[model samples]
Target: MDRNLELMLKEQKTAFYIFDSAVLKKRIMHLRTRLPERLELCYAVKANPFITKEIENETERFEICSPGEYEICKALGIDSRKMVISGIYKTPEVIEGLVSDKDFCGIFTAESVRQYRLLCELSEKYGRKLKVLPRLTNDSQFGIDPEELENIIRERDSHPMIEIIGVQFFSGTQKTSLKKFRRELEMLDSFLEKLKSEFSFEAGELEYGTGFPVSYFRNESLDEDALLEGFSELINGLGFKGRIILEIGRSIAASCGKYYTHIVDIKSNKGINYALIDGGMHHLVYYGQQMAMKQPFLSVIGKDSIIPDKLWTVCGSLCSMNDIVVKQLPLPEIEVGDVLCFENAGAYCMTEGISLLLSRDLPAVYIIKENGELYRVRRTFETLALNMPKYERMD
Candidate 1:
C-alpha cells in the first residue's frame, strides 16, 4: 500500500467534505476577471450555503430563489440591494414579506397575470413600487409565451404598484449547443425591439438565466472566451443600457468538493464483484442517477498493489434495492474497510439528501485547504433538526 494513499483513506472517516475555499476563490476570481464588464455573476444560493459567507465577502451580488434563501443571505449580512429574487412559483407570503421590507430591493419574475396582479397588490399595500421582469418563454417548456409576455407587460404597466424593469429567459440546465443559445438570443432581441417600438418602454436589465456547464461531467468544457463573446455580442445587439445578470449555482460549486465513503463489505453475485459502502443515495443521489451528465471517477486509497482489473458495483448500506453509488465500474482491488473517494460531489448532493429508509445521521462537512489545513464548516445533525418542519414531528 502506498503511504500517501493510506493517509488519504484515513482522512475519509469524516462525513461531509469540501475542497479548499482559497482554491475555489481563485477559480471564481479568474472567471470574474475574464468576463469583467460583460457579466455580473450572481452566486445562486441553492448550491450550498457553506460557501455563502465566503461568496458574500468575495462577490458583489447573489440570486435568491426562496424565502429561506433570502433569510440565509440576510444572516450572511449580504446587502439586499445586491440580491435578485427569482423562482417560477412564489408564495403570497414571500411576495408580501419581501416587498414590505424597505431595505430589500427584490426583482420578481412573473410568468402570468395572476402573479403580476399579486405582486402589484403587494407593492400597493407596501407603498413601494416593486420592480419586476416578465419571464418569457422562448420555445421552451418553462417560462411564459412571447405573446403572453407582451400582454403581461402591457396589462401590468398601467398598474402603479408594479414597475416593469426587464426580461428574463431560462432555456434549461446543461445546455450543450451554442447555436441554440444564439437562436434564443436572436429571439430575445426581436421581442425586445418589438416591445420598445410598440410600447415605447425600454428594458432596465436583460437577465440571461444560468445553465452554464461545469466540469463534473465527462468530456465537457465551457469555452469561457466564446461564451463571453457571444453574451457581449447579444447584449450589444439589444442596445439596452440595463445590466446583464447570470444566476449560476452548480458550475461554481461542483468542482470544489468530493464525497468520501468507506467500503464496508465486498461480495460477488453471479460472478460479478460488488463493493458496498456506508453512504449512497442519502448523500449522493446525483451520482446514483448520473444527473447532469455526472459520471464519477473513483480512486482507491492506501493501496499500492491495487489491481485495475476487478469490476465492482458500488452499493450503499441502506436496505433499499435502488440505493446504488456506481453501477459496474472497473476499479482496483478492494476489501472491507477500504475507502473510496468520489470526485465532484459538491453542488446539490448534500443539500438535497433525504434519510428515508434509515435514520442515519447526515454527514459532517469540512473544507480542505490547498496547504492541507482542514476547517469544519458545518455539521449536519443540528441543521437537519432545525430544517425539519414542526408538522413532521409526531410527538
Candidate 2:
C-alpha cells in the first residue's frame, strides 16, 4: 500500500512547500549588498511570516498592513521601532493601539483630511507623535488622484498635530516596468518639489510601494543592473534629504518555494488526459487565476528518465470546476497516486489561503534546504482543526 501510494504521488503532482529561510536570506542579502547606503529595505510582512525572523535578522526594517500581522511581529519579538503600518482603512482602535506603543511609529495611507485629523487626534491622545506618509496614486487603480493627494498634503500641513513626513506611491501588484516606475517617481518628485517651494514643507521621506515583479507568473527581461541604476538616478534627481524605503513582498518570496500534491485520479478521452491532484485553488488561488495566461509545467519527481511530451490539464480534487493548477501543459504520462509539484508557490499562497468549503483539510507545508534537509514547519490537520467553533442545539 505504501509503495502504491508513493508511485501514485509520483504520478500526480502534489506538495505545498515553503521557501527555506536560508535560501530566502541569501536572496535578500544579495539585494541588500548592492543597495545604496541611504536606501532602506522593508520586507512586506503580508507575503509570508515564515521569513519574519530571517527578515528581522537581515533587513533594517519591515512593513505591516493589518492588525493581525502587527501582532504577529510583536509575538515574534521583532523590534516594533523599525516597523511601518500601511493600509487604506485603519480602525480607531488599531490606530490608538499602535500609537500608544512607544516602539510603534506608523504611517497611515490617508486619502483625506478627515483621516489625517483623526489620526492626529489619536496620536495626541496616545501621547506619541506618529509619522504620516500620504498614499499617492498616479492615474493608477490603487492610488488617489494626483490632485487629491496634493490637496490632502496641503490640508495636513495646516494642522499642528499632523506631520507630513513623506509620500508613498504604489503602481499596483506584479508590475514589471522600469519605465512606469520612473514615470511615477518623476511625478512624485515634481509634486514634492512644488509642495516644498510653495508651502515651505519639507518632504522628509519617499516610499516606493511594493510592485517589484518576481518570477511567479512569467519571467520578464528586467535588467536588474539597469533597474537599480534607474532607481539611483531617480533618488539622486530628487535630492531629498529624507530616507528611501522599499515595501517589497512578492519579489522576495516567489522564487523560493513549491506546492506539491498527490494524484488521486486520472481520466482520458479522445487523446486528452486529466490528472487530478489532492490540492487545488484552495491552496494556491493565484496559480489558478493565472493558469490561462501563464500555465505551469509538470515534471516527475525523483525520476531520471521521465519527461513531459503530451499536454494535460492538471485539476484539483475539489468540487469546483475552476479548481485547476494548469489548464493545459505538455506533461509526462502520469498515473494514479503520483505526486505533482508546482513551482513558485512561496508568496501569497499559504498566507492567503481561504477555506471555501471547510471540508478538505488545509495542505501541509515543509521546507527543504540545499543539503536536502526537510523540516515540517506546519501541519495541515492540526492548524486547520484547532479552535473550530461548535454550535449548540437550540430547543
Q: Each candidate: what lDDT?
A: 0.71, 0.69
**TM-score for each prediction?**
0.84, 0.84
- Candidate 2, position 233, lDDT: 69
Tell me how candidate 2 scores on lDDT: 0.69
Model 1, 1-395: lDDT tens digits are 53433444555463555555776777677667655476677787888777777667666567777888888888878888777777767778887888888878867778666777788788778789878877887565557877777777677557877888888877776655667777877777777878889877778777876576655544456576677566556556655556777767776777677777888888898997888888877887452256222356557765646667877788887788777776767787678877777777767888787754466767777776556666666664534464555775567
Q: Let me know the TM-score candidate 1 reaches against the reference structure.
A: 0.84
RMSD of candidates 1 onward, in order: 4.1, 4.4
Clashes of 2: 22
Task: Write model 2 residue lDDT over 1-395, tens digit each, in one string.
Answer: 23433443443344555566677877777666656767777788888776676568777667777788888888888877677777666676887777776666556666445566677787677666667777776564555676676776667645666677788777677665667877777777777888788767778788877476665444435566666666666667765677778778877777666777777888886876888878777787563355444665335555427777777788776788777677666667777766666667778887676554646777666655545465566666533345566799989
* Residue 28 displacement in candidate 2 (angstroms): 1.5
lDDT of 2 at 253: 78
